[model samples]
Target: MIATSVEQLLNNLEGTVQVKADRVSVIDSRSLQLKVDSIVYNAVFAEGLVRDTARWLLWELGQQLGIYPSSIHEFYMAAGRGELPKSCTVPAINVRAMNFNTSRAVFRAANELSVGALIFEIARSEMGYTDQRPTEYVSSILGAAIKEGFRGPLFIQGDHFQVSAKGFAADPGAEVNAVKDLITESISAGFYNIDIDTSTLVDLSFDSLDDQQRNNYRVCADITRFVRQIEPEGITISLGGEIGEVGGHNSTVPELHAFMRGYNYKIGDLQG
Candidate 1:
């Protein structure tokens, strides 16, 4: 049954989950799937406070059940350091619509294949049109995981947390702050991976590659610092930097070098 209120939700979850004064305990693991399915449905489709409560309960339940939101940064770092052999490409799936069903299908497939390195992401643009905020997005994914009995780290990401070139050009502080605000919201909502797409600010009009990527790297560095400062104590958010805009000219080695040189120099003393 779709829960219409927090009271009804707890009542519906009675046989499967036990709630006692802020503590949630699982009583019947076998029946959890259906109950969680209802919770997620309500989390996504219910109105206002009902939706909020469902999402909050789902998050708490996931944590109690050993399904934690995590970062893929260390995994990628290992691959980059050559400590890991190239085995597979981890897919970052964007659930643009029907987030609940799509994510549920993803968990089902991953369970069948024993895959644990996939990501469920939502871009900044997608968030606007899809009307799925970071909290709702995360809840849908976690709820799917719970329904599937998938116990592990959930890599939810804020994909393409991009800076708008026009907005940045018009008012730099406001645009930068906008992206930072989204980052803060996403992180708070259990998004441990973030792709900062500042490549839109890259100016090809400049003669040198460094000059071209100057604004991009400078803004990226500033945002990176903000992310570092606000991230959870133990979790290091996996951050991606873009050197070129999508559909733009192919990125050359010089462009990558330039972006990295500027980004690293600007990001000095900040641990990634």
Candidate 2:
């Protein structure tokens, strides 16, 4: 989508501006309750300001600062008393972010100290997601990785956030609520993608007359609809429905297709 050559589009944020957390002073000279001097810029890729200007920033950063989140994942967060979108720069995707290796080489040459002109690609580290620890692991990794990159494109993935037996055993509704909270925090942390894996709850034993499995299936369908209904625009977020085992050895193509068709999702649904 960039009109100019990739070589000429490396921008560095470190040189143009500096970020000082201690200098975070919320100015409110207005007589009103809120700060009347609020000004939101379109620089989504800037260090601290929350905006939806990633691609242009990516172009500018690559042209100026030299690094950007690879996926353009739109960000989300819960501020004050409500759930809100913090930044819309990053986009969302349906497929797993790690699946990029299937299309291109996972490794790329890095020049962390080139100091001026350079290039880079999406460098992702798994956020250590098991059923135990939550979103912070991945958020920390993403933040660190973004700082590690010299230029071009650098990004972090929220990987997969799902319902775990351990988390849910405490309470079914609690697991859902916790997952939502994690998602909110991760989006605020500047992760490019949020993979909501509800596949674990689906009842594969639907062939049987099990009520529990049937309930689980309903939950998966419900969650799928929720994601499609609420995800931010241009944020490449993917809601992977439970269409049989995604990592099983015995699931055949026909079975997978049938499972997907049953849920109204196609066999070869292509999403970026």
Candidate 3:
């Protein structure tokens, strides 16, 4: 059953967990796990401040339990340097609905399989229709981790942070700022892996491949710089850029080279 208020939620977790002076203490690990399931449910389904409080408590509990949201940047860098075996592809799951329960199941399966390189992601469009901001989304994922006894770094991602072509055409500054605002929010809420999709700005009317991807790479580079400037000191945010829109023409090798060259030139000495 979902608790209606923070007090009710605390009462429900009486023996399992304790909250005092803004600190959460786990009285019973096994029981707290079960109670966390309901906490996460309330975080996702409860209304108004109840939902907000639930999310806050869940985040606090997750911190105390050592379940931290982290980036996959270093791991990928290691892979790039050939330091790790290329045995499997990391799965990026988009949880549009049932954010808590679905994430719990994913965590449980990952725990059973000893998998660690899984990601929970949501797109900007998904965030709007689903009514899930970055904070709630991160809480849901972390709450699930706590419920399932999953430990270590949790990779939460902002997927397809795309710019709309029509909006960009009408008001380029507003459109870009919208994406930048979302990026700031997502990064603040523990989404260290961000995929910037400026492919919508790609102008195929241009003859040369570099010209075609000029706007795409330029805006992507701008966003990349913004991300680097605002990212947390110790953590390097993993970023991805798109050269072509999905369902459009497949990107050629030359197009990929063109995008990379332009992007690299744009972000001169910036390190991801």
- Give all candidate RMSDs, comma-separated: 1.2, 15.4, 1.5
Q: Which stretches of candidate 1 lie over 4 Å from their true place?
A: none
* Candidate 1, position 185, lDDT: 97
> lDDT score, residue 181, model 2?
62
Put down candidate 1 lDDT per residue, 1-272, tens digits, no spaces.
56667899888887888888888888887798867888888888898888888888888889888998999999999889988868767998999898888888998999999997899999999999999999999998888888888899999999999999999999999999999999999999999999999999999999999999999999999999999999999999999989999885899999999999999999987864
Candidate 1 displacement at residue 231 in angstroms: 0.3
Q: Could you tell me every candidate's TM-score relative to the true structure?
A: 0.97, 0.44, 0.95
Error of 3 at 100 (Å): 1.6
Candidate 2 to truth, TM: 0.44
lDDT of 2 by residue, 94-213 (tens): 222332221112212234323221212121123332221222233222222233333344444445566665666678888777666666655444444555555556555566423323
Give candidate 3's TM-score.
0.95
For model 3, residues 158-196, the per-residue Cα lDDT tens digits are: 999999999999999999999999999998888999999
> Worst 10-residue stretch by lDDT in candidate 2?
32-41
Best candidate (score: lDDT)? 1
How many clashing residue pairs appear in each of the predictions shown? 0, 31, 0
Better of 2 and 3 by TM-score: 3
How many Å off is the CA of 193 in candidate 2? 2.0
